[model samples]
Target: MDFDPPSNFSPELMMRDAAAYRPLFYDPNTTFYNGHDDQHPRRFNEEVTNDWYDFLDGKLTREQIAAFMLEGKKVAAIANSSSPKVKAFERFVRLAHQVDNYACTPINPWSYYNNPQSDTPQKTSEELVEEAIRDYRAETNAFLKNRYAFQALKALFYAGNRDAFERFFGEVEPNMPRNTLYYRALGYRAGFYIEVKDFCNANLLYAEVFNHVPAMRPVAATSLTLQDEKQWEQCLRAASPEQKTALWALLAFRTGDNDRAIRSIYQIRPKDPLLSLLVIRFINENEGRRWSLIGPPTKDADPKANHMKEIPRETFDLIRRIASEEKTENPFLWYAAAGYITSWSGDYDGANSLYDKAAGQMKAGNKEAADQLRLLRLVNALSRITEVKGDNVERLTEELRWLYKQNSYPGYGEGGMRYKTAIEQSATYLSTLYAKAGRPELAEMLDHSSEKIAQPGVVDKLIAVLENPRTPMEKLIVDMYPYTAEEFYFYKALQALHADQLIEAEALMKKAGKQGMTELYTNPFNDYILDPLDAHTRKHIKEAKVKYTPITLIQKMREGEAKIARGEEVYNNSLLVGNAFYNMSFYGTSDIWRVPLLNASIFELVPCYAQEMVMTSPAAKKYYRMALKAATTDEQRAKAVFLSIKCDRNDCYLGPIRGRALCDDQRYMNQSNSPNWLDRDGFGELMRYANTQYYRDVIRECGYFQLYVAKHKR
Candidate 1:
């Protein structure tokens, strides 16, 4: 039931610093096609309109121009629009819409295979394609001509006229500017190669698109499929040197063989920006692989159980050598990565040397780089500690303080910097250290659990340390402890109250201040034990006429016990005391706030507290027996016997065999096949007063008692 929050092995601070290589490599999603940006189309439209605004000499606001294109308004509809640029755009819009009519309806695979019918008539599709081609040839403005050429090729490609599409691309590509639109046309050509089964050329052209256009990388990478080494060699031979390096980069990203790809790309071009992304990605993958080894220590946990894989020696040497050479575009990135890898491999001193080298090479004013190096240094420092002595604990005081401060940083997880993994790992490691150092109370404070603190002396030790912390280690323990001293006092008071230690419970509750004075909705001495699952009981408790705080409830029960001690109204006073204890048990409606660290709303109690809460209430049963011993009439005897039977039934159903059946529905099922209820202590006594009104009421209302009576009479 104890769970740590989601923590990243690769720091987002370092990965996001490679901003230029994003949306292609080192993207957070790392999917085959990085589609994290759903607003790409809207942003693309904005970019297009902004360019148009600049070209038109600010004839209209950018929003207005975008709106004009979005609305598809005709030129003649505009008032006082005599500008030549406006007229040219109007013609372009008409042709663009014509192209869209053909391009928008791609051949749906399901309909094409199932129906084999064209949605648009063949004659109409041919006419639209011809109109686009004619517009491209007649347009005189250079800007409009380029747009027309792209639209014409798009229309041909979508019309299924591949011969015309390829022929027209050849004619226009030589004259077209190498922009996003041109790269898109090349993507279409790549698709043609795919359809013709010329995969080598297809991959070659797709690599070009992937390298040139950042936004188009997803589509290009998705389409670039070199199935085998033969096709890969063919593409390599056909590609230019720059494209060949792009091919290796794409392969590295797709296959995660950064060692091979980095070497290949480095031999080709040492200053390539893509090399930095590959190095970061390689480090991140290895970091994820070795996360458990470097993470918080676990008691009795095998280091080889969860993660046993190791980084290959050759790969480590290659990265370390690359960092040593300092020929990469970002030497600091390489050094930091190599150093982190070295540190996790147990080379603390070597890792520190690499970290110092990285610090020297880090670019000034780069906060991300600075934080990354600091985090690495902290990792190295913590890894250097083999024991939890005073000196070892004091050595990390400032770093531990800095790590704690990151929890409140505005961009702890997603934006500014990521240190959550480091924080969790450090806390776990320190908890283990304190445990090994014979300070289990401090260990439980760092990595806390209700089960551990529920042990006999843990809470007292925690309180003792909080009251008088004498050493630096003890002070740090108090500083890092999550609960306030008052909260521990309240919890300890609740434990004492449950164990029938009234004097100790009262004194501890007094020390708990307002925390121990939380008001209860129902009277604790109510004769009938309310069921939490009953709708009427839930409503009645909310509107109860009487309420008592914990202090007042204990005082009331203490007064009843005092009267019994003085031998005044023994039966009545004893019954009232028994009722108060019963109302605070797990079977009672007012039981929610009775036990500390137990979630009363849940149907079953947690294992550590289940025995005390549900399986037994010796205090309630003991007082009920006193009431039975002092009863003067059959009615008083019947009432005491029936209440005592309620306790017996709870203990039988929730005891070892049945296992925590606290709810009425579960109790009914569990008791159906068993004769155990007939043997409970008070059942025979209740049958002795079968003629009493209390017994008659029990027979009418209680099915199990009614079954007992029928069996006995037969």
Candidate 2:
């Protein structure tokens, strides 16, 4: 088979090829803005070849969408039917990663939201303020192409990158056209001044913002310090009749204006029962009804009770609707049924899809999902009804038998009931199968199988695995998994107390250690091996205490890139950062334990700097090119799609890049990307209404697939 195909292939395989060419594109969890993995270039775009009009027209047929669903030729039909909009956005996302000069890209509905560029770098704070003031006057559209540029400039202002921010602002301001949201941008412009701690300018900008954009006063007020509080309050009192209302409304909320705050909210959305409910809920959630001695005496219990008692009429209506026959399956029921069915049906793919869909419906912090998809494989395997994918059932059985024969014992761990039960059932099945096969040497075969199945000397290991302190006892049990003798030794080291006990166990483990089991015995917790004879010896003690300090992905990728730079070409994504993390240390958990926590503070930092490498590193490019060239599997193709998509976005990837920037900066993205519907603002209902329509559109299209050109190679 050809290791890599030329670009001139059927459109059916184009997405696959692009995916193989750059594996990052198809990652569902990994999102990109205009390509390059959200990393911005330090300099200029190297591959500025295409004008990329195809993205605007949405004419691109991304065949990879098919791979996500069905396999092979079936994908081609799906790709052909996809609308120009889907294709356009996907292509834009891919191109934006590498594209520079966002201004040159064709104007589309989304162009207004696209990030803009600075014509020149400003060098002073005065220059920035002057330029910002001009832009604030010019831009009429609340949304514009320069929004991201403004945002970037705003960030630099906060970072104290004053000169650059100033220079950047100087270029953007004079030229931008005034539009509906121009005042809103000006309001943001004022906020930018505040971020740099410039009070005089901030007040001027805020004055202008209140003059032009009245509703944002409360939001702006929250960011002010105690020193500026009175001036703001005074400004609130002295404002004109128009500004006075909004100004005092915000000040009143700060100075015990609960009624105005409530009224102000009512003015925005006249009958938001949810807002009313939450006001009461907040009182209950934070125990807010209690009054301090500085204010009034408290009857906290009564308010708390009243807050609970005053349920909204809308809520009652919702409670009824939820219980009644709704056409859509309740998220809980759908997931639970899907999980339960997938478990024993050998429908791993289906089960995984169901769980993903369920996750989309789940509320934040809600842990009790319909059912976890984790147990799907186990359920499927046990049911023995769905091993259609390459005869895994026969393979798993034969492999288990062979493993037992090699060990000469198999009852294995008696630790967890699950583990013990699995081993026992496995042995019982093999015994029955062999006995049923019936041969002249059946009795001898049965005896040999029984010896192998008994799990020779495995009780101690089970006890070691179970005794660990963590609720996840599995973390301490290494070899107990996939059941083999070497695992017994790993568990012995982790659970052992006295050096003598360790030494004795060490000898048994070493004697038991065979060729395939050696990798498992290497101390997953520590760097060096433990020989029980010298467990207490200073040398052994010092060695055992050594644990791997995790290094950044950049360092590992640099090493790989350096090798590639030197023309050493054995590069694999798994062996790169993926393997670096994978081999870091598992201690006793599953292989997935090595992957960083998705929402963890540090783990979120991991993908941030990847953008920089994409922009600056030739080795990184070479590696990516080779990876895309070599990718053959559907999973590999998916990764390629992600990388390519990142490259395709017309702007350098900033979000992930900056997120990585703030990784070591020890910052978080406090600015939320939550859909506009969640806020209590008037726009919230409109957003919800729009989203409802969109969702309904999708549901109407659900299982309502349209056929396109049927041929794959065409």
By lDDT, the best candidate is: 1
Q: Evaluate residue 374 in candidate 2 and report its C-alpha lDDT on the 0 to 100 scale.
A: 24
Q: After superposition, how far is residue 95 of candidate 2 from its true place, in Å?
A: 25
Q: Which ten residues in a row have the lowest lDDT in candidate 1?
A: 1-10
- What is candidate 1's lDDT per residue for 45-122, written digit by digit as tens? 766787778877877677667776765653333335788887677667777766665555455657766677855433
Encode model 2's per-residue lDDT on 398-466: one tens digit a residue: 334433333222221111111222333343443344344432122112233212222333235333343
**C-alpha positional error of residue 405 in candidate 2 after TM-score superposition, expressed in Å:** 29
Each candidate structure's TM-score, on Cα atoms with residue i matched to residue i, is 0.84, 0.21
lDDT of each: 0.72, 0.34
Scored by lDDT, model 2 comes in at 0.34
